[model samples]
Target: MTVGPAEARRLSWAQVRARRLAWHGLAEPLKGAGPADVASAMAGTHAQMMSAAELGIALRMDGATRADVREAVWGEHSLIKTFGPRGTVHLLPARELPMWVGALSALPRPSSPHADGVRMAPEQSEQVIAAVGDALRDAELTIDELTEEVVARTGPWAGDLVMPAFQGMWPRWRQSMHEAGIRGLLCFGAGRGRKVTYTSPRRFLPGFAAEEPEAALRGVVRSYLRAYGPSTPQRFAHWLNAPATWASELFASLEAELERVEVEGVDAPQWLAPDASASAFAVPRPRDVAADVPRGVRLLPYFDVYAYRVGNQPPALLYPGRASERVLRGNFQVLLVDGEVAGLWHQRRSGRRIEVTVEPLAPLSRARRSALDDQVARVGEILEARPTLTIGEVTVGGHA
Candidate 1:
């Protein structure tokens, strides 16, 4: 049966609810990869926050000590494997770090200018790795402290070559640490001058290891597909920041575990679990429901993974092309209804009151307007203050 755009656009609330629940409900167990594995699974800062909030995990630091709400879920902080994915440091689960680092290392290096600038020789990379290990032997050092230690050990090489080399070899170093069974759960402790202290390495979670890099990648891919399936290869490639060639190869390698499905009547192809049913495409449920707002408008945080995923796809399911375009400006939060974006909103807090400025992409129907008001009220509850809603002029297509 062909699902037309109109039918897709008219998704029932129940269907939307089911899809949302399915997307965020499952958790992938990391038996051995440690904290690093968890960090690797989270691709960026926004991704990390969303993952943590969804999992009900809290990142906290006291004085000079750092920990999470549930230490048993991961492990103690390991400072050495903190900065990897795109050169940013993240707090990862301890056990799963090794395998995730290994998987990232297995990825082919890019020839892009940025990649070329960051490439390091094998010997130079090894020297920096060893130096870092020595610096953080028993105590955790902040980025600056660790960098200084690397310089002190390697002398002139440390100051000029080692520092630069470390940047290039970070990803590989993470892979090596994972291979050696080191976890990645480094956290921000107290700041000493400009340097920060981190937590020591200790087993945070049990049952994860770094062996079988290929198997680990396959497993991660499987989970991603299951949670965010009915998506195109291009989308997967974008999500991983991987080359198309590599993405296709990875998909081919996992063919036995994945099923290819047509996106209803569209020419687009999606990959899902072999056992996924047709109902998998049902719309998602509302993440939050406000008693005061109308039924249709919902506010979502900026860089919401949902917004990121659907940015380039068919608009029939959500906002029209113009509305989506306005949301892409990346300046404000989003307003969504029935799994589609309807407008943009900006929030300002003053004393006890919160001010909200909204710009709808199109003229709101009476039903949609009522739904929006209810959503605003929910926002008020979250901020612990009443909200003053201000509506902005609508913009259509490229014209305002």
Candidate 2:
């Protein structure tokens, strides 16, 4: 039987953060590490905004640049852009596509929100999914070309441009793109001029095939726990944008693999597992282990994966300071100090110069202020811009 939280020993949040920081590879930028390594470590680096996502990888990799990231995606074909956790776009390692494909395919999807006229029936949806794969076999096609292929295969109804998108409508068949992506039938291909293209995963991975759902789920769950564990079912559910009940059932099923513990001040229990890198319940004195935990000032781009955490955990437990909230989301660039959200920052670029504004939510020591200077310079290196720092209230409405 799994030990309950009450029976488990308590650890200070500082100790837990130390372990988490090590797991996140935040001690220093990794030398000679490629984009895929960082993506796998992050479980798949968030790529809703490719610029910021590239920065996320560069932050952990030594002397890396944006060109390296593009090369991984479009040149070396080692990373593929596809639907990731919470249905957002991410750059996933091509080698791990089997598990990512299988695990995402197994997740429950809500029925299409479009009205019946714009929505494809279950049978039609299946047909479109199949057609999408067949149309893209060993071929790359833009949205227009793919639509023509799908319409030809599934009939004119599938081509109806009725589903509302950002500023216009998308074809009825486009609704299945998410399923087509995770089903291992489709992935992003090189752009044709300015238009985005789609191609089969087989184009990059010759022997590509999704693993069994059960096995793949286990693999991904282990990866997730390794990077963000000591996490609760609810928090895991939230991170995956999955149903709380589904997460609860998945965790229950993995009881044998997980060990539970209660971090002081956190109302719910967290779970972690043994891995090659560290002990399961071994949060010790700072002197007892390698002191590679997160420290000093770091400027993280918007939508960085480290932003994941529950909102209710006491702010002081993570960010040392006077702060109101912990869950930083959307366009706000993160000013992370010592493994937590210390403030919010934003940047604007002109020619070769970038203007950075940082708002600290807590007090900073003199040494930390000096460190911020170095951090800003590093940001400049990643962005290939000269950075000018302004320490003041970021007046933007959302800190974007």
Candidate 3:
């Protein structure tokens, strides 16, 4: 059906939750899938904080653990660490790096924040990215080592580059690090002592060849739609960290493979992939039992892709006056119940035990409260630590 903006199917909040939960592999804990599968399923886990990424992947699986993630990256070579959406570190399946590389590389680089005369120009950034790849071929180096090598190869100007950031001087050349990752030249490696390390993606997948930018980006858009669609071009733009005009242009090219859908109470028309099922838009009836709890209750860490992907939606629909602008803007970890944000959670290691505190936005049923306990138990298993749960009073728009 040709659903124009006016005739779009209004997707109720429950329907939205159901569709997202299913796509997220949270409808049921995924069985027998490795960490690589977890990364691939959600496009990629948010790895800006590596622990959160590990937990994010483990939460979607029946029995995965941090060791599983370590083995995948450090031993099995099934996953590669690289910068992804929003220029943050992410764990991506090694096999899919080329497409990610090509698509991300195609995005226009943001303007340098340094003074006009101090900023490295696009051409200079490219030179540094190439140098980084060359320097790390089959080897791992810390940031200082990589920086020195980049200067040696790219010229003195690379080291001279600096910019003001947060009222402090920032290494301007470090901006190209993201570019290096997108170009399949750089990734995070096991650190040495307390020092961070970098390596080439070739260390994990030798001789990886990238797809042409256009074709690869088409695949990316399709993947995004598969995992998080019934969405808009503007949302896609945000997800990609691309300019809206560019995202709209790219999305328009895929119209033949997309269809418009109503997202219930949302006024704007949302689009989904051509193969999306009609059931995804059905008005969901409230359940008497904890239907979404047994299989989907989760303690998703901060900046989890699921929350970030859906953050732009109307607040009332998910957690009603619970999400603050700062919480949304800063990306906080949350307690997800029945495919919606039910509360916020925090954890700290106190000796061998993980002390967990939860603050819900509203009162939950007895079944839901029990399910939350189960979720805590699952987290304890993953962390290999005894867990202590403290239920805090429901507080709206408070930081965890």
Candidate 4:
């Protein structure tokens, strides 16, 4: 087999898992770091679901409670929730919003020929973006309220651009909200009753200025590699939701900072920080799985960044063999033991009682079963509910 320039090293599956755990801050949870530290380590948490984001951050920090996270976000305002990498909701460190704003604002505006004549003109899009920032500057407003303010500022043309969407007729111009958030001009705010609200990131984090675009984007690339490297440009592109050509070009400019090395099981060259050593991949595996192989157990939450961001691999690899696509679709919400999907677990609360159910992909060893019990106790502690355990056969995509 011809090993090309891309195929520089071979990394065993164990080596891959070892490096992943270390990079993810899981091999050893961080000490004395706050929620922002955890966010910075992973670039950002997958935060479409607020609970998942909170759990993801807590898992990475020692002694961080739900209240601590809430304080950082709503009280101290150290973390900001907004649209981030890949145009998705994420929890980012408030201090870093300027850099994110600069980098994300540099991406080419999205256009869709498939739209039924409802797209915003580039100039109109910019106007809407500015309007969103201005409207939310004084106070948090619900989406409807924000839209009305935008319409009042940008006139009827902005309000008239509605298009069909899965959620039904959405104002085409409002798509710029994602852009506004990425540009550090807007973010999610505390709710009013059941109504979600938006506010300017500067409402709490003041005086942040966007860094020069190219330098800001270069920093983003560096952070991604720091958290998930020994990877290729293709993987970086996939994670960033950018064109492969764009990522490759960026990587080319970063040649002096990255060192290419061969991995045991991979066919392509992987790049890492020049100061990083291959010894990270040679760490001893846990004794339990070290013998029979593939050890370490964790009950990760829905959209945990760990499961969502594996480089180049299908997300299904997290689950066991022959697991149904339905199950794999829900895999991000499942339990993982040894880096592979081991089971499904869910929690429900009633009064002071929280019911947690587990359904393993297959029968587990005594050690793994004990590990599952420990996770159940930990879940109960995090939720502050007296938890009862239920174990059985779980049908994928069904209520736990």
Which candidate number has the best TM-score? 2
TM-score of each: 0.62, 0.89, 0.88, 0.87
Candidate 2 C-alpha lDDT tens digits along 277-321: 643222232223223445757787877724444322555566454
- Mark the 10 consecutive residues where model 4 has the least summed lDDT: 282-291
Residues 278-303 of candidate 4: C-alpha lDDT, one tens digit per residue: 33122222222212334566767777
| Clash statistics: count for each candidate | 40, 0, 6, 11
Task: Kindly indicate the candidate among 1 and 2 with the higher lDDT.
Answer: 2
* lDDT (C-alpha, whole model) for all candidates: 0.47, 0.77, 0.73, 0.71
- Candidate 3 on 1-400: residue-level lDDT in tens? 4556666555566666766676566766555678887777677777777788778778877787787888898788788888998887888888788899989988976666666767677799888888998999978999888889988998877876466558766555787788788788899888799998999878777688888999899878877766676678888888877898998899888776766776666776677664323322221221221134323567878678353354236655565456543244545668777766667788888777998888777787898888889989988888878998999943434334
Off by over 4 Å in 4: 1-10, 165-167, 274-294, 305-308, 312-320, 323-326, 396-400
In TM-score terms, candidate 2 sits at 0.89
By summed lDDT, the worst window of 10 consecutive residues in model 3 runs over 281-290
The candidate maximizing lDDT is 2
lDDT of 3 at 370: 89
Residue 275, candidate 2: alpha-carbon lDDT = 66
Please state the error at residue 212 of candidate 3 in Å: 1.6
Off by over 4 Å in 3: 1-10, 164-170, 274-296, 305-308, 324-330, 393-400
